[model samples]
Target: MPVSDLTAALADVRALLLAPDDLVRAVAAGRRRGVEPPAAERVEVRPVALRAGPHLQLVSRTGPVVSTVNAPLGERAAAAVDDLLAQPFGNFHVETSSQVLQLRVTKRGEAQVHRSATSRRAVQAGPQAHDRTKQRLVDPDDPLFRVLGAGGDKRRQVDAFVRQLAPLAPRALDAAAGRELRAVDLGCGNAYLTFAAHRWLAGRAGEDGAALRTVGVDVRPDVVERSERLAGEAGLAGLSFAVGSIVDADPFDGAAPDVVLALHACDTATDDALARAVRWGSPVVLAAPCCHRDVQRQIAGARAGDGLGGGRGGAGEPLVRHPILRERFADVLTDALRALVLQVLGYRVEVVEFVDSRHTPRNALLRAVRTGGPRPEHLAELDALRAQWGVEPVLARRLAPQLDAVRALA
Candidate 1:
């Protein structure tokens, strides 16, 4: 076991737990690094039926007593697994339909990994897996989906995306009440999620007998044309597509949007979208950022002498030294900065799962709802993080005016 392989092995364990269909059982046992496990450290994972739905039940056993917790099968389950990995657990055993994996951490904190094929029959003989049944938000046969070629796998993703926004729609609509609610979806490549957003909002508006308008913007003219044509054929009103970059798009015709969405916008394009949302003072913003090349490159180019490589002694150097870990950490750092900036601009921000990880790797969503003024503590936190990383997020630059006002308050 070497330092280089440890992170990859841990990442693989994470992937296995995230695979809702394959994960049968997993256990994290033993301890090391001179850190004690919380209460009962020996934890076992199994699929279980919960009142809400199917969940991955985590049972921590110590002698005759056991403490249990349940995490919904998806990104949340992956998060629970992460909490366990952060512990001093020295060994991990995972069983799936196709394989079994065992990872033991050596005294040096290096990982020794072993994996073997497991027959599906033997895997199935164990506890039954969670039921994969999920209620659909949008029917696959709907004219909107059929016309857009969003069926089967694509439809599943659409449903998941729609479900992600389902809870927030009521609140957004309540604020609009008697007025027409407007939404703008930026970087809407094929406009699948854009159309779905429109449908969801429109339906909710219809219940209250209110009006709803949704606009989809993309840089590609061809994709815009196809989306527009599909909307026409589907006879969906108050829904349209426009060709323009997120920064330059005037899809709302100068009117501020009630809801601003940017799903899977690449790199700095997401920053552009967020800047626009802040300038417009959009009440609600949902953005699922795709690539984090901006911050990733900055971290890669940082120097140890400047305290950019995770401080003077390079305490955080190992995380950024590895290409894969650096990329992943950059993603987290970028989103965290985005969330902080949103807070600085007077929005209560939440970074949560945009969709099940199975549908897409870029599942993290920044859901922001405007509350009031920025908190000095949050602004300080933002500054501390940027200073520590020796990186200026493109978003921080993009929203400089708004952030400056927040800073002046301090």
Candidate 2:
């Protein structure tokens, strides 16, 4: 429990890193004693083969995005492990061929060490960049999949969608800090993600005996009715749906949701969902934008204006010179602005590819958690981007009230 005890536990973890041949995996998760949480919420390291010989691959997840770095086995990898241990992570777990070692950092900064024998095998005899095979989180044969009429490509899609959320959902609930989790899915077409999210989250909540409630909102009455019927057939509790557009949905009935999801909401509909989330002060928000037509139109209209590779042939003009390229450029610019807007409006945001393009071309997901107001640099960058593009994002406009409030304080 003393400082020396914590140091001893860390030494054990570091020693394991040195023995790469026996190391299966190491993970550091949760937050410990700190005024500010670590930059990455979770960090994992595993043994891998590189041309030079054995190496350790470190994968760090800050929010939705993950960054990977490789260090050669031995001192370098041990140093990397030391850096990770320095962070205020509550749990440090190591798995090896012979034993599992877990070092837990209590809230009072006491160190608790637990060791147990394991039948788990060590690193395989070759360079493995990825898992040989992964167990599917959403099995194709799941009854919920059957209830949703998902099979073949549809089932694969549902599985991928849930895979994207797996890493972030638990953290989102943690942000609730043991309170009941209330979620709302905007523009939930047929409520595939709505159903899946609720089921997954409910299971998680059940683990801790925490309550969870989720609702799906869409504009089509028939879709809502079908979703409701499907929910009934699946026999899931605390899930419901409402018929209304993302812009007009009052599905929460004035209660702000803890987690907000807007998956593949078309064009500015994504903006509408985001605007609502910001206004409601939702703790966590995830949106996958589809169709950049709004920004595309703005870019086209501004082509003849200044600073846009105006017909005068500015450097930026070439990117928007071709219609197809312009469309793609708009897609990038649109999401960038949306992310920046959230950053400016007191949310920590990350833009990442939630799923592979093969599953869905519209796979860019914006994952955010409300943190606090924007720093001066973010505001300056937003202004510069708006000035250069000569286009105000629909999200920026829709979020005027909140944005204005933040700017006023700044």
Candidate 3:
């Protein structure tokens, strides 16, 4: 950019930051000319309220280590933005209370800017962004993409999976933490998520100078063979698949994984995957469960002597009096206990509606990150629920040996 144009951009940035409640978020990223140290490769600025008053947060990211500083919205905030833009950060995205604006720098050092004043908001809420410019790891035309199929819904599912992995990835990339990430996918029918995850990590590794590898395991020999074939055809050397059950499969012949996944694994298979992930001590674990038949059956087992099975005599009997309500209750109760067990196993767990219900009714996604050993409060909640429910969850029963230690601590 010319010196005159550069001056104008900085002036405009300063005015926005100085304005109250006008600047929603501003990000300056993608280094130009690959500058040297302490000058973070990426920086983000946003408005937030502190104990003192309103402040702007400037977060600078240099590889795995990030430095953040809060400056009141004024000259200091403007300087932070100016410093980054001055270094010629190649990308700019500013979202205001009114509209969103974008600026981009070309390889020829020419600035290409665009601004729209329409009062519109982003479709998705969060830091999850899908870069349209970059070549997707799994292109729609590629053989791998064939597994996810043609629908935009399937594509969105893949994109969402990749985007969600971005925030938690830094822990694995920490300079002191291991830079190599090994991921295993259990019950990977067609290995859709397996390939997406490997590609996602591969992209991150390239940007952060790390390493990544993956394995996809399934019991169906044909699907496993197909996945292996696709990996070979796509030249994905770091990814492989084998015909083995989620409960028995050991990826790469027993290599411990840094992340474990079980997307849409059926019935008790989800439990098996979680138990394996816990055993692996994976830094990140995620699952999109397919069915809750096990819990539903257990809940229905409490039938009266006639065995007509109308929610007989359990603590939450009336809850299952209606068939549809029983199904919904089983899903909630099943996931609740699963989250509780994960918490007891030192993981901070969250249950999310990963995909739209239109895609599938069974859309619950379980995301767990290893934090530390079990917390007393979380375990107490689990115990109370279990005692009241009058039935042991499959996961709780399977993980009893581990849960016992956590209970002792509780």
Off by over 4 Å in 1: 1-132, 309-313
TM-score of each: 0.69, 0.82, 0.67
Expressed as tens digits, the lDDT of each residue in 169-230 for candidate 2 is 54566555557788999999978888988987886666546788899999889998999999
- Candidate 3 lDDT over 115-162, as tens digits, reads 655243322211222221222224545455764453666766776676
Residue 293 in candidate 2 has what lDDT? Answer: 97
Estimate the TM-score for candidate 1. Answer: 0.69
Worst lDDT 10-window in candidate 3? 123-132
Off by over 4 Å in 2: 1-33, 39-44, 61-68, 74-76, 90-131, 175-178, 307-311
State the lDDT of candidate 1 residue by residue for 239-307, as single tens digits. 988888898878768988889999989999999999999888887889989999989888876744575
Error of 3 at 144 (Å): 4.3
